[model samples]
Target: MHLKIGEVSTIVVSSPEVAKEVLQTNDLNFADRPHQLGADIMCYGSTDIATSPYGGYWKQLRKICTIELLGATRVRSFQSIREEEVSKLITYISANTGSSINLSNKVAAMTSSITSRASFGVKYKDQDAFISLMRKLVTLAEGFIIMDLFPSQKWLHIISGMKPKLEKMHKQFDMIFENIIAEVEKTGGEVETESLLSVLLNIKDHQDLGFPLTMNNIKAVILDMFVAGSETTSAVIDWTMSEILKNPRVMIKAQEEVRKVFGSKGYSDETSLEDLKYLKAVIKETLRLHPPTPLLLPRECRETCDLKGYTIPVGTKVIVNAWAIGRDPEYWSEPEKFVPERFIDHPIDYKGFNMEYIPFGAGRRSCPGISFALPSIELCLAQLLYYYNWDLPSGGIMENIQMTEALGSSSRRASNLILVPISHNHV
Candidate 1:
């Protein structure tokens, strides 16, 4: 698991035991985030919580993120937005029930709309353009991982042209955020309800936070949260659906649970989904196999330390392969199979406490947005199960459905998830 990638000496943690050590036992030693050219350009010099250096400033930003931006209360406040967007998605599916519809595109759009509305509020004057811009930025930001490996080689960044491309997109992102900030400033915070942007603007002048919150800071945080919220949430739903479809037994059992639990209510919502244990298990299984960020954001060793027998020198990059750890045969009974039943009665959960199941990650830098993400992921799957009976398109075989991971920034299926939806009511 130890090797040299380009000029960087790296350690890849693929076992749960080593993962716990890096993420928890010696978390402080590996808490720092490595510099990425794409993140620097997109996140305003890595000032965002996800890319920021581990320190008082980053700690303060994480506090704001957990308490103000994506805390339980904040996540609860966005329920209506999620429900509304998911409803539109259900309707769209119902309308095209007999034909093949691209589930991935619809899911992505719904999540994007929800993220935008939650971040900037209902009046998004340039939503179409902004969403398009965000899509590009997320792809570019994640693309920077490879270029970052050769950080000492400055010429490679220029020769690849990714830096200039990111700079150009960053300008576009800056302008869009400026308009949104201007709108928030004119209103002097929201009159009735506060969006994430308004919340930050209202407290930007507060002196207790330790770091001055600038316009760029606000913009970077927004971009980071948006990318994490929209792209990954949709990807999980896509994978969950794909898994359920490929395994007919899971699909039937999950749909039965969803219908029995929420079918009586005519629609599924965030609150009611808590009772669908089977559906939740299915989602957990999906996350176990297809983590949103398979190789999580790289962590830099702050100081030299002895990990087991090896000397992990200072400044070495460490990557905890959550995907590999989740599928480790020592931990899972049948690592390759799509078995939701394995998690149905298990005590392990996704709260990062159980090292074997750190889907949202673990320790101080763990994703604080879990509360913000789960409701969307749960609601989308519940509604899909409760409303439709999906099938492969004509001539398509379920066993042959491609689960090939996409080559881009995320682990999305290379091809679109085109399925035929049969109305549950009609069935």
Candidate 2:
């Protein structure tokens, strides 16, 4: 469909066929990331995987992501961390039995802690500082900066005063990242721990791949893992909790299934996690309704490509609205409702494909953290439901739950998901 945002004429590709063309068939013609002054400065001039232009360098970085960091073997190695965190969540909920709990905040903290530990080997003792900083940066990045829309409007940064704010944020981020890098370096490179940063530092030492990994590149990668991995995973858990709470029957059934399968496990472990298939379905359904990143990061056309009858010009910014596509009436029945049963026997999965379910995106440029994210979300949701019966605080009803979307580089729950948890007898 045609869309007019201000003076620009844009086409919105809500159809799966068109989405396929832009994301897969003519994928190369649409793999570039839209340039942003703030993003460039934050990512150390597009050195990160998410913003880097498609080329040999990007390919190499993507390889490092897939084969080393987010690869199946490496992701599996973090199972212990996930299990330990989920256990902590369960314990916290149990302790707060009768009081209202902000599940979103807790989940966000859990994911961020896990990501920090896994990626940087540092877990923030006071997570709020990090979370606040990230939220601020996300807001700055998502807003419409004049520089992004009109590359020629270079003076607007000064006139609008966005330059100073952007510079301040950049400095703050650099200090945080550099501090972590320095601490890692202090470990003397012989630590038995195998965190992502340690691996990257090792590769940097070898420097056999032509371009050596600079401090800027290392910082960008660390930022990507922290921001991209943390917020989205936390948001997914929040949505899952909200949906299940809204539908108490579904919540009960899911909880029962988890408790039944894990019975005497004492804690939610990797073994028990594999058996919570119904809970997994709940997470998939949540992603369907509330894609953390409502609009997948904008992709720029690399070359001219024909879609339907129109020629998509090279360098044109293309955005795949996974949010709308996931809820398209033609694809999902009662698209707005939260229903995990929809996946009972359905083969559609989020490892891309199933255009109607492109939560993690599709094809070559799809999110590399898909494996890490799903398990983390699944385990957290399962543990929460298995151990507690949730209700809104102070006579709060499902309607009272805030469904407002937080505006940022990604979509998230506008309000912290606060609920009272009652200890489950079965567990």
Candidate 3:
């Protein structure tokens, strides 16, 4: 689908074949991200990995992410943090058992705490401040500002007063991150486990890649981790739980699988995630139905290319609707249903292959936090399902549960998911 938003030519890819062509075959041609007004103001001029233009700097940052920041070993190092946080969540739910509880808020806070400890060594005193700023950033980044569509109209930003608002938010975030950096520097090599911040600070001076990372670069990367890691993971988990609760059979089967895996030993850490195959499928199905980033970050055409014989000119903004692609009836059977069994026999993985099921996207601009996120999600979901059984707060009535969506770049349930918890011991 091709349309014109002001002076910008926009292409929306809604099919798997075209997605493959754009995200894989001709990925380099559309590798660059479109510059958005909100992203420009929030991402430190697109220095972050998600918004950075395709070039040596992006390659270097991606290399640092894979090799140093979000490597397999580094993700595993945060296991204890995840376990502690999951325990906290379980305890909170237990206290509120037999009454309506806001599962959405609890899960979001849990993920936020886990990301905070893993990234900054300790939760910041002003953690709520960070969350508030991050919510505004996501909302703005996903918004369609007039200045973004009509890049030639530079004066419109000032006239509309959006630029100043963005600048104020950016300054507040800068102060918060700068204080975080200062505190981390004060602790200098004294911590047992290395946070991502420490690792980046260690390499801030190195220029082997022909470009040194500035403080802004480090801060931008931190923002990427927080924004991508906390909210998206929590949303997916919330959606997965909602699906399970709506389908009693699925909830029973998944819980049985989780319990049988741990058997006598209860609530193990991420290491046990490998044994929960059914739960894994549940998550995959949830992501298929509800990808965290539905449209994904927009890609800018870096060079002229012919896709499906459509002469896509240079500088056209490409939008691949992963949400639509996932539900396309051509690939999925009864695509609207939450059927985890579909993945039990299928060989689809989240590594962005096959194009038919890329929740995290594919190719050069694919999300790099997958390694850091998948385990956290699986572990968190496993613990939640293992510890207790969930019921809709609607007095044992299942139909009252609503699956309505709030769509954007980051899609979540339109309303908070409230559920009543029943302990396994009581059951």
Candidate 4:
């Protein structure tokens, strides 16, 4: 469907076939990210991977992302970090056993800490403030304000007060990054291993890439990792848990699978994560239903192209509604239901192929942090189900759990999920 919103030509793709045509068939034609006001200010000229216009520079950055930054090796190197944090979450839940606890906050903090330690080899002194700042930035970065819709109206930004808000947020963001970078530099590589920041700093100092890396580039890349890794991963895990709690049968089956696979050993680890087949299926179904970004980051057309007989002119903004496509009845049987069994032996994966299930999106601009995120998500969920039998807080019913989608570009739950935990007998 085509929409003309304040001079911006917008095209929305809500069908699997159309999504494929746009994301894969003519991937190059829509390789560039649309210039949005939030990215322009927050990402320092939109130099980050998600906002960068498609070009040789973008390609170079992507290459580094896939091979060095978020490669198999780099993701694997963070295993211990994931284990420690997830274990802490489990311990916290256990300590508060029987009383109501805020699972949403606990999970978010756990994931953010893991992302921070993996990035800087340490956690921030004011971690809570940092998380709050990230939440605000993500909401703004969705670009829903009037200023974004009418980009040509430069003076309108000031009148609406959007410019000042973004400018203030950007300074807070920079100050945080500056302090962290300075701390990392003072260490002088004294740490035994290189953090993600260290890797970027190393590459920048040596001018090791075809495209030079500026300080802004480094900061922007790190921001991308947090938004993708910490925010998205935590939200997915939260949704998966909510779904499981609402469906007792799913909860039982998932727990059995996690326990049976990691049982006797009483632990979750890289070696055992693959064996939790049903658990993996649970995650797939969750993503299918609650993709963090219902509509993925927009792509700008680089050339005129024919999309399933529709003429898409150059410069039109393209948005693939993963939420709608994932729920299309034509592609999925009982699409609205949370049935992990449907995916138990299913060949469908979310890695862009089979556009019907693109949780992380498809094609050239798909999220590159999947390798960096899935482990934390899988590990946290698997452990939560493995060690405890969860219960709704006193008098709370499964059906009443707030499954309402919160407003914003991010599809988070409107309410914090509260639950009671009971230790399980592994034997």
Clashes per model (N, Cα, C within 3 A): 0, 1, 0, 0
Q: What digit string (tens of lDDT, one per residue) describes model 4 on residues 1-427?
A: 9999987899999999989888998899988988877888888888888888899888988887898789888888888888989889988987898899999999999999999888888777767888999888877766577866887888888788888898899999899989887877787766535688888888898865766799999899888888998999999999999999889889999988888888878776667999889999999999999998999999999988888888888999999999999899998999999999989888998788989999999999999998899999999998888889887877688866779988878889888988998888751
Give the winner by TM-score: 2 or 3. 3
Q: List pairs with backbone clashes in candidate 4.
A: none
lDDT of 3 by residue, 1-427 (tens): 9989999999999999999999999999999988877777788998999998899999999999989989888988988888888888888887887888989888888888888888888777777888878778777766678898899988898777889889999999999888876776688656547888888877986546688888898888988998778988888888998888888889899989988887667554666788888998999999999988999789999888899988999999999999999999999999998899999968999889879999999998999888877877888888778778777765767755798987566888989998888787622
Q: Residue 357 in model 4: shift from native, Å? A: 0.8
Off by over 4 Å in 2: 2-9, 189-192
* Candidate maximizing lDDT: 4
* TM-score versus the correct structure, for each prediction: 0.95, 0.95, 0.97, 0.97
Taking the tens digit of each residue's C-alpha lDDT, what string does model 2 give over 1-427? Answer: 7654533335666767788888878877777887778778888898898889888778888888888888888888888888877778787888889998888788888898888878876664446777888878888877777767767667777877887998888898787776766776776654334889887877889857667788788788878887767888998888888888888878889988988887776555676677777887888898888887778888877777778899877667788888899998998899988889998878998887777788878877888877778778887877787777777888888755778787765778778888898887744
lDDT of candidates 1 onward, in order: 0.84, 0.79, 0.86, 0.88
TM-score leader? 4
Runs of candidate 1 with Cα error greater than 4 angstroms are 123-125, 141-147, 183-192
- What TM-score should be assigned to candidate 4? 0.97
Positional deviation of residue 42's Cα in model 1 after best superposition, in angstroms: 0.6
Report the C-alpha displacement of residue 299, candidate 2, in angstroms: 1.2
Clashes of 4: 0
Error of 2 at 257 (Å): 0.7
